[model samples]
Target: MTKPTPLSGFPELLPAQRIAELAVIDHLRRTFELHGFASIETRIVETLDRLAKGGEIDKEIYVLRRLHADDDSSDSGLALHFDLTVPFARYVLENSGRLEFPFRRYQIQKAWRGERPQEGRFREFTQADVDIVARDELGLHYDVEVARVMAEALADLPLPPMTLQTNSRRLIEGFYRGLGVADPHLVISIMDKLDKAAAEVISRRLVDEAGLDDEQALLCLRLAEIRTRDTSFVEQVRALGVEHELLETGLTELAAVIDGCADVSSDRFRVEANLRIARGLDYYTGTVFEIYMEGHESLGSVGGGGRYDA
Candidate 1:
């Protein structure tokens, strides 16, 4: 008989808010389909083992439990999916025999995560993802294509100007290797916090946790500071004197993506190379992306995705 209590992380949009969101989703759908991306929906729940394949999000996964069910129930190993990309990968594997090579698919669905909710982040939220997957190999050109499609979709919407910040895992990993860092992945995990933490704090963590020497930590910080709208970033990284074949490959690939997206970029949308964007997930390889609205920078990334090994 008490009044209903509102949950903090579960957001409920009002009629007006929902109308606006639907319109945006619709526009995204049209844009995606126009780009030859077919629509698909994945199950909300996946086996914990399969979900854990994504990365270090085991703590944030929402386990599925059934009331009045026995301990031996088949649901014991199930949990709600944290992100669409993980599930999409599973889908591709399960249906690989029927799907075409370099299959482009778009999925807009609710995903659940048990993280603290603040600003743009929520425990339960709807996400739209567009991914292109292949059987044996995937071309790099699809990377540029997807970025342009998303940028065009956002431009037609009534949102503020957007910037798609990009980085390369090959670049980060190779750079760390060149520095003789013992654990490049661990360093990346710590460096990903550059946006949320101060330079001094990250530098200390890099030295303490990632086991980097003082000089190496300083160099890592220097690498993280490089950002550019064009291929100018290439010189900045080379100036640091780190050399590795993977680093060179990443530099060329990332530069191509930025240059390729240049034609579609305008006052509304732009793509830039930001070396500090170490997207926290170990599965991400090659090019990584993070989209941000100009005035809402503090809300964290509005949208983000990255390439993974097939």
Candidate 2:
């Protein structure tokens, strides 16, 4: 008899868990549609160049090739969609004229990643996303409202408490530029790894590898550790002797988001200044968000997204 084979990283949920997951999905879909987001879907395969835009996502992509593609000419390195955002961006660009401005849409689909997956992190998993993209620019208030709605949808889930750690890329970039940092992207990339790497290791790498001085590297590390529920985090960052127009602007927008969601009784939503939440995608140009489980902080972000004004 042939032996049975088990797939690696791909998970199978128990009957009870599947029921719970379905209930969660159904609730989220209804909430999203209620907010006027229409539904859409994109094809599974995308070209290699589009998938490899930022270099970081390349590692996670699961490349595909035709069965008869034996030569380099046929080896285009198409890949399974790693996340919903990239495909959505391509969809918007392709269907620009036919689509309405400030397009609001919801996409729920399975995404594949070549990751060493664990319980929550899987090789193939479902992502339920709701986003609003404008032809020109989206207002900051809209950004806050999306976060508010998402929080409400997940409030009843039987999971650990989660907080939306929000920050603005414009704010961080401005601060870095004002500090005379020549390569802000490089700095942001390094800072994004703070959660995975230790403070000492990060500081050393920034100083020795990225050419930042000890003081600057230390300051960046300290900023990564600073998190809060409101604009209070801004005062803490200011006390560190770092003040810049971009940082202040980010703080102001974050304050508006906190105030807008003030009616939400759950403390699960907060504004954290030290949130070094660079989504690592080149498209996101404004406010970035990260959802963290309260007790399982080390498991990394469970959900995240940001505004892409390009």
Candidate 3:
């Protein structure tokens, strides 16, 4: 008889391991309920059309296939969801009639992606998300609320010190457009790699692919280097000498978010205004978030999400 082989990405924990995992989930559920957030779970699969609405996600989806299809039979146009946010948004739209304004919900589920296994990265993982979605318009205060809730959640868990690095897509986009760059989105996609790639490599890509002059590329690299815990980042961006209404608005909004959290005495979890956090998703039009442990920065963000007003 042949020995059974385990699938590469799909992991099955031992009985003891799963018991420990369930305890953590219980803590999260209690914390969420304590904050008046209702729990809701969506189906594990979503339509490929919805998943691929944002072009950047095309490479990461795992398509579902039928078991007994003929040669000419096509896929069912469905795939396992890569993350919880996309599915949650679709659910809100479909059930808009039954839901209330400014809905507060918490979801914890497993998600699958087609990513290659690498150090500090995975193809299958569990994600816990807490979101406050609204009907007409969501207040900026909720943004700060999210930061506080997540920070408190992490503090409850047995983890090291954490820093929630946040930035505004509008802030970066406006900064680029103010420089007369025709495609700020493309510039942002490239700038997102600043952490993985060196400044020279990014500058070269900006010039060769994104069509930026050497001077403009250098300016972007300088901007991406700014990281601050307080409102000092506002001064750093202003010193760049690039002025625009969007940029001004973004700076003000970003400052307000950082300050709002700070005033809540959220010092248990450090928060910072980090300009280099682009989040890669185009729909993330407003502030973006990326959380990292103090000494485990190389592990990447343990959790992240942001405003997508559009």
The deviation in Å at residue 278 for candidate 2 is 3.0
Task: Name the TM-score of candidate 3.
Answer: 0.89
After superposing candidate 1 on the true structure, give the runs of residues whose Cα lies further than 4 Å from its correct spot. 1-5, 52-56, 65-76, 115-120
TM-score per prediction, in order, is 0.90, 0.86, 0.89
Counting clashing residue pairs in each candidate, in order, gives 0, 0, 0
Candidate 2 yields a Cα-based lDDT of 0.79
Q: Indicate the residue-level lDDT of 282 in model 3.
A: 61
Model 2: per-residue Cα lDDT over 205-295, one tens digit each: 8887778888888777776667776667667777777767887887677667766766763755443534577787467787888888888
Higher-TM-score candidate of 2 and 3: 3
State residue 235's C-alpha deviation in candidate 3, in Å: 1.4
User: Can you give the lDDT of residue 273 in candidate 1?
Assistant: 95
RMSD (CA, Å), each prediction: 2.4, 3.2, 2.8
Whole-model lDDT, model 3: 0.87
- Best candidate (score: lDDT): 1
Per-residue alpha-carbon lDDT of model 3 for 106-145, expressed as tens digits? 9999998888776646678899999998887888888888
Better of 1 and 3 by lDDT: 1
lDDT score at residue 260, model 3, on the 0-100 scale: 85
